[model samples]
Target: MKRRLLLVSNSTLHGGGYLQHCQQQIQDFFGKEVKRILFVPYALHDRDAYTKTARDKFKTLGLCLYHMDVEHTVTATVIFISDVLFFSLFPGYEVESVHETPDPVDAVRKAEGIFIGGGNTFRLLKALYDNKLVTEIKKRVLEDGIPYMGSSAGTNVSTISINTTNDMPIVYPPTFAAIGLVPFNINPHYLDPDPNSKHMGETREQRITQYHEELETPSVLGLREGSMLLVEGNKATLLGSTKARLFQRGKQTTEYEPGSDLSFLLTDAQ
Candidate 1:
């Protein structure tokens, strides 16, 4: 099955309510057939609050949002044996094992749609690893063709890796690698350099250029606020009012307006 994804730059725009900027696109993407959506809100510190916020927004779109909190237990077994050669001598061996409840993985398997909210990229990716949902989510979206939606950090994790994310590394994950729902990397909430600004720090474009300096790194798409990418089968189109910037190694950065075709990003080649 072809992968279906709606990767959004940011959930909320300035002066806009939560997900108000792209609400229509979200509803149209999921459509009426998908009434229930499995939401992953691990990016924020308080999962409950984040889930609640997302749930309320999705509910307005006529969809029910449910989140999963995986619960598991670890058990250790100790075996004691007596040595025949030496009387009163004892040796002990300990083994550790983990057992999981079927709820978490089962939820992904049965989910008709998945929505990952925005926050810190590191935290989100780490939580995915901790809950062992990376492979399960990928299989569900890529193989089962379930509709997938991501915003900000959620969008970051949808790419090949989170190297292009602007969020600080408040936490470390198992690796920078992500879901690879898309072949390229993404820098959400991308900002343009202010010619009149006094700040001397590297601009977003400069940072993306530095990323391109790496050997064989995939292309990076800088998604500005209020911008999103709609991927359907083999076609990917830029959506919303803003324009997106594309950065490739040894090439000039290119800009694309809304309605532009971005299907090239789906391929392995840069």
Candidate 2:
């Protein structure tokens, strides 16, 4: 059986329309027989950040959230710090709190569909690799042919490496380390037409351009909040009203309109 991957940007069950769009995308790809395994490394905000109401709405289509993390040499220390500072500061929701000593490869092997949530892509990538779970997740996708999904940090980590993310550089990520799940780096919430005066920041498109110049290897895909990349077997198609912008090495940027076939991108990535 072939697995389908649904890579989402940041999603808000209460505000953003992306959540409903994500549900439709998931249903379009996985159909009625789907099981969702969520990986929330950055769910530091709340234990049940992905609320039961949201999970239950999508659960009808076989959605489930698993507090999955790569337990390894590095995660041991991070988990300790997270437990003391992160968990103590805010105590209400359910935190998975997996032990650092246990192997993470087992978790990746059991998952059929993986959803990586937003926040700190670099730290998440480092934790995954240090725990030896990154290798297994790749195997699950490339070798086992399972569906690999991402959003925000999840989408950013799927690239060869994401040098630029929207958030501040709170942690220095391991250089050139990532899941390599997707050939292109994704800038979610991309293309902010207007600028905010309070924050000193570059627009999403501007940041993506800077990343392309720095890496000069992998291409960058700019996906707006509601847009997603749908992959089945070796084929990929763009879903939603938004268009996808592609920035390749030594090539002028071009736009692929919505409903256009994206089989070429998938072929190159594979």
TM-score of every model versus the real structure: 0.84, 0.72
lDDT tens readout by residue for model 2, 109-188:
76655656676766666666666776777778777776666777777777666664566666665575576666666677
**Tens-digit lDDT string for candidate 1 (139-177):** 989998999999999999988999999999999999999
Model 2 worst lDDT window (10 residues): 92-101
Give the top-scoring candidate (TM-score): 1
Clashing pairs in 1: none
Write down the RMSD of candidate 2 (Cα, Å). 13.0
lDDT of each: 0.82, 0.60
Where model 1 places Cα greater than 4 Å from the true spot, the runs are 62-102
How high a TM-score does candidate 1 get? 0.84
Per-residue lDDT for 178 in model 2? 71
Point out where model 2 deviates above 4 Å: 1-3, 13-18, 36-38, 43-54, 60-103, 195-200, 267-270
